[model samples]
Target: MSRRRHENFRELLSKREGFTVSQVSFQNEVLEAHNYYRDLHCAPPLQLDNKLSRSAQIFAEELASKNQFYHSNTKGVGENLYMASGSNVDSLTGKLSSNQQISSSFSYANIAGDAPVTDWYNEIEQYDFDYPGFSGATGHFTQVVWKNSKNLGVGIAYTSEGDSVYVVAQYTPPGNYQDQFPDNVFPEGQC
Candidate 1:
């Protein structure tokens, strides 16, 4: 099939399968979210790196295509991945009424554009500021605000079945190294 025709067919199939394909790039949203959290931690802002973004995008697409969730083996970079399914509910006002019954079917609601970043940043709640250290639970949060991580890259993709979405973000000069956590990840408001 011609590329255009194939694209149209895929779109039609997605709709029929209860998946709304989103081509929206969450780059800006992701960047803003990262900087927002970084600022709170008194870390300098990170600039977006195109090469890293491309690499991240490729990995994200691979995860989506294979319907798998795992970290990439790419060296020399810190990575974070997020996968979520169900309706693309809005963060602020997507709450369902108590009386509302949940449905197994999916809705066409657009995916929460900033969900991945939000979820990653939310890990801060579990982070201990007084004793900074590396922990699987708070790694994502730490990478976002890692003081020495100066470059950022973000990528997002949806599963082939359209039932899930995956987000991948990479950081330069990766963070969370042993014995360096105290210096790289600082207490809130302490640069």
Candidate 2:
């Protein structure tokens, strides 16, 4: 490329929004968080899959660049997505109310690295082990602890403007099968 073109390209790149590729530490944080929750339900730990990670990363980038939220079209892979925006970059914490309701508190700042995974796991409060089945509200939690899901891949991207974050987690041998919930999603403390 010519010098002028090279300078112009650099300028364009600089104007682009900032995106954070999943680093080793961030990946570990997500994995550990999932395992912690999985253990509660007696599910085994999940291994990280590179191929799924790459696919998830690509989708995460797309979502961040476009500032949109949606699931990927990848067939047969279980997926979860989370997006949060604010001025406060600290961790977001929530709790179930006395009536078993989700009460959330928001602050101004960017989202913390592991907050998305925690948020996804918190859906457990809505999951019913006795009537194990798919529900939009608890799908993310079920996917995290699905015994049939042996592999996991996660991707995260921060919006170019640094005001939001998008998280994607993909699973192999996906969970939430209509007839397989009984076998895949077990009661807590039962393997």
Candidate 3:
């Protein structure tokens, strides 16, 4: 492991909860063991909507009228091996088709459809999110390719009735927001 790279990761790990840095360096290989983790993709960004109405004028009105609480979170793993395995992999060329991760939005409502979508999660659907326990957490996240190519990805997920909502807008800086390293991620492919 390169000494510079190893030190860089060790410093990053120090910021996580319960991380303790050892004043003594060469004595232990524990810090060196974490080198490989540097290659893993960084976690997706979490942007909280201060107002639910920002999703879209019509969609927002539908949400407020129902007296339901709706929350949306998106995550895009630049290169998803699990999802890509299903199709479109040109092994001959190093350029593999990147895939998006699963992102879900759930609402707190007695009447599922009443959350305004009225039949979204139940009817006009693309993929059903079924996992035993976490019922409310069901939605689709976007996919971002790490490659240096111009590509546009559209992710529209609401449910069989209305499981998720996507709202696009320029982010107004929040007072408490901690911008991740290098803006969105850790120096992109370098990290």
Candidate 4:
């Protein structure tokens, strides 16, 4: 048994025939030992196991945005209201918001493509509200009703962490939700 063990050891050394095993070779020896030991006892390999082996360094970053546009009482007639969000979101390496103003709601649906998130003010918008009549209602506030509505929308984006990338799915809505437009005809919501 001792002779057989000696022969096995010699066989491993002979397998590297004509190769120089210098002090630097110690690193390779340790790695070889670890690989062989791990093959028998380690956990299952991960998806990125060998993919990053050749790269000197790997890095990743994640970014997100919760862009919103909201407004109230922009006009006197019908008390038009507008709200929208996340118009033309795009891929990038950092966080950002639409260049339009949250207080600017009347411009919904008017903005052209390639505009900043802020430019969302150009879009056409509408809202629903109930008003009360008052005898002393000299100022507009006397008959005004203050209210806020919740909107929801859904979108997709790519996120990264460490050396991994993930696809993120989300839902969102316009800033103000309106359903009282009896004249508004569409299969669902238009656009």
Candidate 5:
């Protein structure tokens, strides 16, 4: 993977290929990713009436107003009410409300495209294991966010860690979740 700090989405876009680089004009990746995740998990499509829709617009405004936004790409992209997290989420990624409700949720902002893994299946084919996540991890993913008053925001996930990149979008409401388990023993929740 490239060691140079991405600084901002613009800088990051410049490093990517297959799309015209622009903060405002370049949204295919965002839309595609959102759609892909939405369908895979069968989540609701973007609703104009939802509060998250407005949040997305304000985020775009903030990004456009900036002269040159810069951020680090070393860490994976994520956000939580208390602290952003990865694998250790169930441990320390949320803040329960006075009513004992978890106040934060996660959603993929972008996810469209297919990176054929079979193409990488070559005993004799050399691989670029150093490319971001792993060898044969084709395609790209990204995101840009702006939090509300408490305003906790996170940038796109710049990683080569998927089989494809379609069905992506730019906004996801907090608290939304997917039903990953039907027979799960845990009390019936969004899981």
Candidate 6:
């Protein structure tokens, strides 16, 4: 483990969670025990604390209209292997394919799609303050991903939807948000 690299990682970790000089040094020592920071990819460090939110204009009548989806891909492992030793003959061969395996998953949410979208949206917007669950404790949020070569990412979302006002808490990552080091367990790979 290079002392310089260890020291650098220590510096970054210190900025995380307000670590004291001694704590930073101690963690660095622990990290060095396994050379955990050796394979750390410094470029585009992993994003650890990513929060997402989104909202759309739905008719008040469409109160029951709702949908949500999640997707994921697991790759990097070698191809699957099968063993064969039947009566005909005994042989060993490698099974490989150019394309990465893809598995799809889906989830469906039922929304009250029968309501008048315009009236519902306007009603929610106007009476959001008076709306019991829609105010203070509830609100709307938004999340958008721009399609650019840079893959520029920006998230603007709401957490607590409010009453007749339907006020929302600003979705901002904690100032401590930073790229993960060493493990990079939470890599934000291309979608």
Q: Model 3, residue 79: displacement in angstroms? A: 20
lDDT of 5 at 156: 23
Would you give me the overall lDDT of model 2?
A: 0.71
TM-score per candidate, in order? Answer: 0.76, 0.76, 0.17, 0.13, 0.23, 0.13
The stretch of ten residues in a row with the least summed lDDT in candidate 4 is: 53-62
The C-alpha RMSD in Å for every predicted model, in order, reads 6.8, 9.0, 21.8, 28.2, 19.0, 24.8
**Model 4: per-residue Cα lDDT over 106-170, one tens digit each:** 11122221121112211212212133222222111111111121111111111111111111111
Candidate 6 regions off by >4 Å? 1-104, 107-123, 127-134, 141-170, 173-191
After superposition, candidate 5 runs with Cα above 4 Å error: 1-21, 47-172, 176-191
Off by over 4 Å in 2: 1-22, 91-113
Question: How far out, in Å, is residue 169 in model 3?
Answer: 12
Error of 5 at 176 (Å): 5.3
CA shift at 154, candidate 5, in angstroms? 9.8
Against the reference, the lDDT scores of all candidates come to 0.72, 0.71, 0.23, 0.21, 0.25, 0.19
Kindly provide the TM-score of model 1 when superposed on the true structure, using C-alpha atoms: 0.76
Candidate 3 per-residue C-alpha lDDT over 1-191 given as tens digits, one digit per residue, 9 for 90 to 100 = 45466445534533433212221121012112112122232423323222311222223223333434343232221210100112222221123233422211111111111121212122213322221111122111111211121222111112222222332211222111122222322322543
Instruction: Give the CA lDDT, 0 to 100, for residue 27 in model 5.
Output: 38
Q: Which candidate would rank higher by TM-score, 4 or 6?
A: 4
Predicted candidate 1 versus true structure: per-residue lDDT over 1-191, tens digit per residue: 45466456645543442222233235666788888888888888898887787678778878877888999999999999988755432342144333443222222233454677778888989998888888999999999889899988776666545556677899998998888888888777876
Q: For residues 1-191, what per-residue lDDT tens digits would candidate 2 score against the true structure?
A: 45466445434533444323324456667788888878888888998887787677778868977899989999989998988665432244232122432111111122244577778878889988888899999999889889889888877665655456678899998998897888877777887
How many collisions per candidate? 0, 8, 18, 23, 29, 29
